[model samples]
Target: MPCVLTPDPTAQETPARPTSTSTSLRDRSSAMLREHLRPTIQFLLVGGVVFLLDTAMYNLLVFWSPSHGWGTGLMHGTPLTAKVLTIAVASCLTYLGNRLWTFGDRPRPGTTRSIMLFILVNLIAAGLQLSCLGFSRYVLGLDSVLADNISGTLIGQVVSTSFRYVTYGRLVFPKH
Candidate 1:
């Protein structure tokens, strides 16, 4: 008679496929990420447009020398004023874009309260930008356009944008 091997009953077995629970958990995590990421992406796109607009407006107000004009800018010798004006306009655009697209799915709060909070948050963000600009202009005494752009546009914006992103989601557009 030919010898036959017996099956071992004590062997450990590895799963050939993922369990349904694990797969469902992964799917849920992916969906949550997409939901959050979509708004962030939209916010950044809107911010990009607003940034370009703000840059153009600021440059025009601070550096533009018209053919028939003798001044270096419409707001010559007043960089701070120009920055304020540009920010004001950009704030309006930012509000509309965030409301209509970025946080569109969020529940709407009272219009008056929401607008007030939005303004307050923007004021704080603007203060961050202004502080950088002022430091570059007054403290550091760097008055050149290059210095202004580096401090106000680049550095300042980085700080302010970070603040705005966090505050806008929490205060202005609560998920609840």
Candidate 2:
């Protein structure tokens, strides 16, 4: 005990290290991606339902009406008429789905206001689809049923759905 001294055990213990920058950055990136993707995923899920309803209604009105001899005059098995009716019905379904699921967490507006805004957004989207159909049927002279589906249902829907998703998120269900 004359000269030798023992080291304090506490002095040798190291403090816990803070998270590395790389780790923190990675975590932040992952969190941001998840936050962004969640709404998009929800929208697509709702859209799938809307699309099924829309396609089914469209086919029924266009093909079934002719066979069943249901419609008359302008309401008959015209592509425009079928599209209008199917899209109207689909828009209603879309509104319900988006309100209940897609933007459910956002603050809900008054029912009337919400519906009006939703309808307005859909009108713009519908216009886009209609334009595609008109161009294909009239301008491009590709009036076949296949052409109508390609131009209006496939191409136009892709574009309009993108526009609708952005507008609905920003305008209809804005963050507070």
Candidate 3:
């Protein structure tokens, strides 16, 4: 008999490749993540710029004095008012940036409706920020520069930014 090799019929087979269904599911998930990620990054970038502006303006309004020449520890005697002013300016810039850049691809229902929803969402977010600041200033009785920045600028921004991101996507610039 001629020498020949034969494969065993009972041998275990290698794992099968993923089916088209699974592959497509994975692709869809990746696409969805990418879709959200770009906007998230853009939103954060816009936020960073606005944050710097807000911090500077707030500090100037609350802490600055002609006698002190900056950081002189003189209180402007109106922390809450300063916070409101800075947040209002920052919110306006945020709206423009988010509408033009962050969520530009999403369709706008109408200019009036979109603006109204944007303002509503921002008002809620601003309330959250103000609450943080107010709690720190009134409840905790911490009114130093460091305290104000930590409570109002840092912590408040974090909470409000999260709220704004979610609401902006769902209400202001919906994917639909």
After superposing all C-alphas onto the true structure, candidate 2 shows an RMSD in angstroms of 6.6
RMSD of each: 4.0, 6.6, 3.6
The TM-score that candidate 2 achieves is 0.76
lDDT of 2 at 11: 85
**TM-score of every model?**
0.83, 0.76, 0.86
Worst 10 residues of 1 by lDDT: 67-76
Clashing pairs in 3: none
Which residue runs does candidate 3 get wrong by more than 4 Å? Answer: 1-15, 19-22, 71-75
Instruction: Give the lowest summed-lDDT range of ten residues in model 2.
Output: 68-77
Q: lDDT tens digits, residues 1-176, model 1?
A: 99999878898787799989999999999999988798889989999999989988888888787864433777768898999999999999999999989998888967787789999999999999999999999999987778888999889888999999999998898888
* TM-score of candidate 1 relative to the true fold: 0.83
1 or 2, greater by lDDT: 1
Number of backbone collisions per candidate: 0, 0, 0
Cα shift from native, residue 50, model 2 (Å): 1.2
Give the Cα error of residue 57 in candidate 3, in Å.
0.5
lDDT of 2 by residue, 3-101 (tens): 988898778777987679978999999999987798899899888888878766765555454545533323333677778788898888888888888
